[model samples]
Target: MTDAPLIDPFQRAVNYLRVSVTDRCDFRCVYCMAENMTFLPKKELLTLEELDRVCTNFVELGVEKLRITGGEPLVRRGIMTFFDSMSRHLESGALRELTLTTNGSQLERFADDLWAAGVRRVNISLDTINEAKFAEVTRWGRLPQVLRGIDAAQRVGMRVKINAVALKGFNESELFDLTEWCASRDMDLTWIEVMPMGDLGNEDRLDQYWSLKDLRARLAERYTVTDLSERSGGPARYVRLEETGQKIGFITPLTHNFCESCNRVRLTCTGELFMCLGQEDMYDLRPALRGSSDDTALKEAIRAAIALKPKGHDFDYSRQRPDGQMTRHMSHTGG
Candidate 1:
C-alpha cells in the first residue's frame, strides 16, 4: 500500500472512485441525451481490460470503494466477466466495496450474476414512478422493466438505492409520494437537484432549483425526520424517518455544493480521468498504461489528477456553461 494519507485539498479522506466503464447507454433520458445525439466511436472507448488495470492501481493507492457506472453499465459486453476479474481483487481484501449504478433497463438479467461476481450494492436511477411520465423522461425505457430490476435487486439482498433527479416542473411533485413509497418497503431514496451540465433549452429551468432545506420543509409536514450524525459516501445530506425505518436524502449540488468533502475521482468511458464533476480537466491514463511499464508513473498521474481537484463547483447554470467544462452526457459520465 502507498501508506499516503487520504486527505485532499480540504484534508478529507479521498478513497472512493466512480469508474465509467463505457459511455454507451441503452436508454436516452431527457437530462443526459440530446434529442439528436452522436455517441463516441467504438475505438475511442476504453476496453474492459483497461478498466481492470485502472481498478487494480486505484486499490493499491488506498481506494477501497469502487462503483461501476456508465451511460448504462449493463450495455457493455462481458461486464460480469470484468466484475469477475475485479472480484479476485476484492476477495483478497484489497477492495472493501464493489457497487454499480444503472438505469435498470438490463439490471434484472445481470443482478444475480453481478452479486455472484462480488458486487454487493447497486444504485438504480428511477426518476418518476409514473409509467407514462417515466417513458416520457427516459424516451426509450419501459417502467415495468425498471421496476422489476429494482425488485430483483432487493430480493437478492443487495444494497438498493433509488436515485431520482427532482426536476422542477416534471417530477418535483412526486418527492413526498416517492418518500412514502420507499418507507413502505424500507428502501433508501436520494433526491438530486438537476444541474445544468449540458443543454436542455430553458436557462431559467435552474431558477426553480429546490435545496435540501426546501425538501425537508415539505416532508416534515408528514413524517418527522432526524438528521444522522454519521456521514456516509459522498456529499449526500441524510435524514432518517422519525418513526419508520426508511432513509431519505438530498444531493443538493445546486444550492449547497459539497465539493469540500468529495472523495471521488470519476474515470470516463475512454479512460480519461475527471477530478471533479464541474471541472473540464482530464489526464489520459489509457495511453500511459499502454506505453509505460512504470507503475509509479501511473500512480503519480492519479495523484496529480487528485491534486488538481477544484474546491467546489459554482451552480450558476442560468449563466453560460462554464468554459472547458468537458462533462459529457450525465449518462456517459455515470451521474
Candidate 2:
C-alpha cells in the first residue's frame, strides 16, 4: 500500500495515535460541550472490528502506542469487548502500551474490568477537588463518584494520571492543595491551560483561560523543579517533584508549544483523521473502513493523509481567530 509510515512530510516519525471510540459524554463541562447538544448517531460510529483494523494498520507501520479516548470511553456500550479485542494486539506485541482517557464518571464500575482487559495506564479529567466547586464546574458531576473511580483504578495497580484544567476564576486557588494531595498519593499530575477551542457552548469560556506559566512560577516557591531528562513520550515535559515519586507536568499549547516535536495523530470515532489537534485539517475514512475488508486500502489512505501533516498549529490567541478555534471542540476530536 505504501512505504513505512515512519516519516511524515516534516520528517517527524509518528509513533502515537489517539483513537476516539465515541462522541457521547455524560458530563456537560463548560469548556468541553454545551448543555444542549445532539450527539452522533450510533450507526455513524465505526464498529469495533473496524477500529481494530484501523489500530492494527497503525501498529503495522511503527506506531507502538495506542490511547483510546471518547466523549467518555466508558459510556460506549460493548466497550469492554472492544478492549478485549485491543488487548490481543498488546499480547501479540504489536502495541507496546494501551491507555485510556476518561472523565472518571464510570471508572469505579469499570476499573477492574479495564485492568483485566490489559489497560495499565489511565488519565482522569478532574478540574477541582472541592465537592461544591466540582459540582459547579461539571454542571451535574459528583466529586465522590469521580474520586471513587480514581481509587478503583489505583487499586487495580493501573498507572493513574490526573489531568486538571487550570481555570483562572475557579480552580486557580485550589491548584496547590490539589497538587499536594496528588503528590502525597504518589500519582502523576498534570495541569492543562484552559484553551478556547471550537465554538464552545459557553461563550465566556475563553475568559476563564489560565496560564500554566503562572502555575509553575507559584509552585516553584515551595518545591524544587527540575526538568526530567526523559518523560513518558507524550506531549507534556515532565519535571520530577522534589522528594516524591510523583511528577508535575504542564501542557501549555498557548505559552509553550510542543509542535516542533509533535508525533501524535488522531482518529475520531466516525473515522475522520486529524493530523493536528489544533488544525481544521480532517480526512474521512468511514467509506474505506466499511467498504472493503482489505487492510492495505486503509493503510494506504492513512499514509496519504498523514503525508500532508502540518508543521505546527501557529495558534496566536491575540489574532482574530486561532486555527484551533475553528476546529472541532476537544471532545469531538477526542479527549
Candidate 3:
C-alpha cells in the first residue's frame, strides 16, 4: 500500500466510503424503488468476504470512515459477519467509524450484534410516524415493526438518527411532529429533498420535489433555527434549535448542491464505484478484485475513479421537470 492519501483531481482528500452490501430490500419504499421492483441476481453481488477485502483496501488507502448501506443493509443474510470483519479496522484505529444506514425493520434482531461489532451510531429512515401514512410511504412496511426496531437500537445504547424525506404534500404536515418525536428521544433528525432517480411507475418525481429551503423556512416559524458549522462527513448541513436544543439537518441536493465539499464515494453491490450521486459516471472494480489475489489492480482502479470525480452533480428541478435524472433507482446505488 502507498503511504499517500487518496486525493481527488480537485485536491479533496477522499476518506469516506459508502458500500452497498446488497441491492435487495424487504420494504418497497415508494420514493426509493418501484412498487414491483426487480432486484439483482444474488450471484452478481460481491460476497461478504469480497466486500471485506474491497473495504479493507479502501481503509488501507487512507479511508477513515466506512458506512454500510443497501436497499436495506440489515436484511442481508449473515450480514453481521461483514460487520464483524470490519470491526478489526475499528479496533486497530485505522478506521474512525463503521456504521450503517438502515430502514429499522431488522434492528430488533440485529441491534445487539451491531453494537457488539463496534457500531455506535446508526441512521434510520423513518418518513412518518403515522401508521397509515407510514404504510402509504413505505408501501409494504408496518409502523409497529419499525418502532420496535428503533426501541431495540436505543436500548442497546446505540445513537439513533432519523432521516426523513421532505415530500411536498406527503410529509410536510408531519415536520413538527417528527421533530418533536426525535427531540424527545434525544435523536437528531435530518430532512432530505427528494432526488430525481429511477422512474417510479405511478410516482412522479416532479410532484415530489420538496425543496429543503422551504422546509427550513417552515421550521424557523416554530423554532429558533441557527446554522452550525459542524458537518458529519456527509451532504447534510446542520442547524441547532435553541428552543429544544435539538440538532436538525437538511440535505438539499437540488436546492443547494453539496458537491463542492464531496469527500466520499459510493460502491454498489456489484463493485461499481459512483463518484457522484446524480451522475451516471462509474468505474467497475470487480474485474480488478476478481482478477487477482493481489490488491494492486483494485487500489489503482479506485484511484483512477477518484481522479474522474466531477466537481458537482447536475440535479436540477428548476425547469419544472426532473432534469439530470439517472436511469437507476436510488436503491441501486445504496440510497
CA-lDDT, candidates in order: 0.79, 0.84, 0.92
TM-scores, each model vs. reference:
0.92, 0.95, 0.98
lDDT of 3 by residue, 296-334 (tens): 888898898999998999999888988898889998899
Q: Mark the regions of model 1 whose C-alpha exceeds 4 Å error after superposition.
A: 1-7, 201-204, 317-327
lDDT per residue (tens digit) for residues 101-171 in model 1: 99988878987898898888888898888899998888888999988898888888888888888777777
Off by over 4 Å in 2: 1-3, 243-245, 318-324
Lowest lDDT block of 10, candidate 2: 318-327
The digit string of per-residue lDDT tens for model 2 on 1-335 reads 35476678999999999999998888878888777758988999998888888888888998989999988899998889889988888999878999999999999999999999899999999989999999887887899999999999999999889999989889889977898889876788998877767676536645786778888888888788888877566668788767665788898888788888888899999999999887888888777777788877787788877887899886666553444565467788796
Supply the global lDDT for candidate 3. 0.92
Worst 10 residues of 1 by lDDT: 317-326
Clashes of 3: 0
Residue 225, candidate 1: C-alpha displacement in angstroms: 1.3
- The candidates, ranked best first by lDDT, are 3, 2, 1
Candidate 1 versus truth, CA RMSD in Å, comes to: 2.4
**Candidate 3 C-alpha error for residue 210, in Å:** 1.5
